[model samples]
Target: MPMLGFLERLKFAQNFCKSTSLVSLILVIQSQLTLTIVPLHFSSSHILIKLSISALLLIIISGFSKCLKRLFGVSASAPALVLFNVLFVWGMHLFVIQKAIPSAANVGFNMECVLLMIGFFSILASDPGWVTDDCYGLEGAVGGTVSDAGRPCEALEVTAELSLSGGSFATRRIRYCKSCKRDIIGFDHHCPAFGNCIGKNNHPLFMVLLVGFLAVEIAYIVSSTQFTKESAIMGSALLETTLSGNLVVSTMLFSALQVLWQIVFLMWHVYCICFNIKTEEWINWKKYPEFQLPIQSQLGESYSEMAFINPYDKGISRNIMEFLSSTG
Candidate 1:
């Protein structure tokens, strides 16, 4: 994308072209989303519902603003996810919260919704380390395992600094991400939909986002899916609840399907956390053979050889705690 424009220079616009398209699409779809589910007289409750949707729409627009995009580049699916999350929240507010859907109207449910938003935006707006040409000079080789000034997805382990014509300074080899064409502080994977790397720093946030979405879905389904004579309150509406008569049911079902996949994703990451390894390491474990380090006796004579170990594993409890506590 062109970086010369006023919107591009702002940095946090989260991809100007994509965001603009997203906003345009939402404007076009607004009417369809508000279509009435059943015939009924206009009332004060319906007016409140409309106002709630308008407020939520404004919030969604802000999310697409330059603020987040300037800070952290957005994923390909970033706009869609934000839109879905906003609409989902609005649906609950209109159909369930407004009508007081039994136990669904409690503070706890409201809190869950809050967390759902936190995790959603936190994942999208935070920087996932991206590698760029600046990490190595133009002459450096790129991505080669053998050391050179610059290379693709690889760096030379600089044991010491060499005097240069320009100047001299201490240097070190950092992680290189070939796919992203940049050096990452702690490189992980480049998520295509997310349009960035899930590096060491932001991985945990992604985890929190996945789990939060799943948990919210579970709660939303349990309380809002019940059909009963309570439906009498809704008049011509099919069910007694807000969830029944509106397009909210479609949203809820979509959430459930999305959560099902997220459950599998969450389980995989949980195992990785317990084992103290990343998805990249797990996938390529066989390619990288493990070696044993020499062990020494008290007197300094060699006693035995220690097996290759996972340095990150500090036991399951410690591992979990460490990951949760990690800045990532």
Candidate 2:
């Protein structure tokens, strides 16, 4: 028992360290960026700073937009909107809000920024479980003709007839993503913010991104409120004020609005995860026999009702585990 306990502790310690590695790396990069930008922000001429920030923003937008477009055929608007929101929030927090608050709170605020960036970049960079031609068996007898990806379903057969509730069953179909020109396993939906499809491989990271955004947006609203209160109480002039009060208020309101919608989205996704249902499946439940179960109506033997029931559900705990453990 002692040995087992020691092993469990060791495993937990390792997992904890692994989880924190991204935050540590982000802190290092954030420190370097702060060192480089702070001087330019304060000492440089206003026009020069504005031009530099604008140029950097454009470069980032262009680079991400081009990559997303090439890979997923997404337009520039997606990245541009998300990047602008992130930049505006982080800029206000770093330059404007932080000045009003105590230095100790800055670390926590910076950590939130790190989480948001890590979540965003991780989701953006991840593969969404795309199925390629190589996945098909080359040596097997042909069960189907060549697919759009030039891959044939092998002799073993890729399709399966899944049993659903109420004695209903359906042939599970593989979804082909037109944007990526590939089939996706456990496909969810195409996310404009990440400029990628959410699927088995990246859905967990997408959840993390939503959670991180929620945290940051809440912090933003709180910090904005604190700054307003402090400025009113002390009657102090805005420190190194570059943006106007209206811009700050507008950003805060935007974050507030995001919190509202994101909470709804996050809760819906939570329910979906618990029930092992995908957004696509939930929205198009009528199309999938697995999601429809027969129900007897009060009108008697001749009458019946159809209800939504997720066939893939394996109970909450196992469903959550399966989702987290999915690799492709």
Candidate 3:
């Protein structure tokens, strides 16, 4: 009887872990899907808003660790988890529920959502840590760790002198980054997307990219909502109340899902902004003192206070730039 009881408890724990992991995975997929679908409506003004929000959120989340530690005395990881939950819920609604149904507008939305989900999740799951290259250099210089040839490497130490050069100074001996074909100051990895490394010099840009992604998604969701409403009104047939009712139901479901996803993402971004930290630094805080160091200490001269910038140029600026740059 004792043995059976123990076995049952163990099984329950294992199941719980599995369920939690699965849920997390699903949410990640949904968030990515929303991002992918958003691009389809690039022409819409809402896309710009969403992109802005995403970029802002990324910036906030990147800096969350410090805020939490100083203000609330909590781990930045806690807020990160919250943000992930928000993003997951929002993405599920936008991509899965909204796009799952068949309609002209919905079809486009769904396609974008599906693509976003697949692409985003693929990137997240692949765990492409800090990218390194000759242009950008190393990643997690301030504080983080990575596996090299089956061994763990410490994050680059940030010294006053090193900060000026945007390089890392670690106790561990310096090594060559094959991707960059040079001995990186901090020596992270090469991120192909940015054509640079995620070291001290480019961390700000990486944060910008993350925030941009979030903002774009939000804008897409808002604009799509308007289109969805118009579509339903036009397509509704009085004679077939059942069809109309179904359409309403589908819209409600999609809206609800989207709301949830946005809430989760918003919360997470809020936390990050308030705290001052990134996912990588949070994960390996103990291993690296760089993360443990105060934000004031880590910040370098190049670290601009205005890290978040609007991705798009508006008004006359945009018009003139487009006209001048476009090929006639």
TM-score of the candidate numbered 1?
A: 0.56
Candidate 3: minimum summed lDDT over ten consecutive residues — where?
Answer: 304-313
Q: lDDT of model 1 at residue 211? A: 71
The local distance difference test score of each candidate is 0.51, 0.62, 0.40
Report residue 292 deviation for candidate 3 (angstroms).
13
Please give the distance, in angstroms, between residue 61's alpha carbon in candidate 2 and its true position after superposition.
19
Q: What TM-score does structure 3 among the candidates reach?
A: 0.30
Off by over 4 Å in 1: 1-79, 95-97, 102-106, 129-153, 156-179, 227-229, 232-246, 286-314
TM-score (C-alpha) between model 2 and the true structure: 0.64
Quote each prediction's TM-score: 0.56, 0.64, 0.30
Query: Tens digits of per-residue lDDT for model 3 on 1-328?
Result: 4465357446534543443445444443443443432233332335345455445434554365457457865432222233354455345445544553446655554455555444433332221222223222444444555546422332443333443454423422233445544343323345543333434333333444445445545544554455455455324454433332333333333334445555675555344333433333344444443333333335556552222211112454553443233211
How many steric clashes between backbone atoms does each model show?
25, 0, 49
| Clashes by residue pair, model 2 | none
Task: Order the candidates by TM-score, highest first.
Answer: 2, 1, 3
Strongest candidate by TM-score? 2
Output the number of the lDDT-best candidate: 2
**lDDT pick, better of 2 and 3:** 2
User: Model 2, which residues run further than 4 Å from truth?
Assistant: 1-75, 138-143, 147-174, 233-243, 293-307
For candidate 1, what is the total of clashing residue pairs? 25
Model 3 Cα displacement at 183 (Å)? 17
* Predicted candidate 3, C-alpha RMSD: 16.1
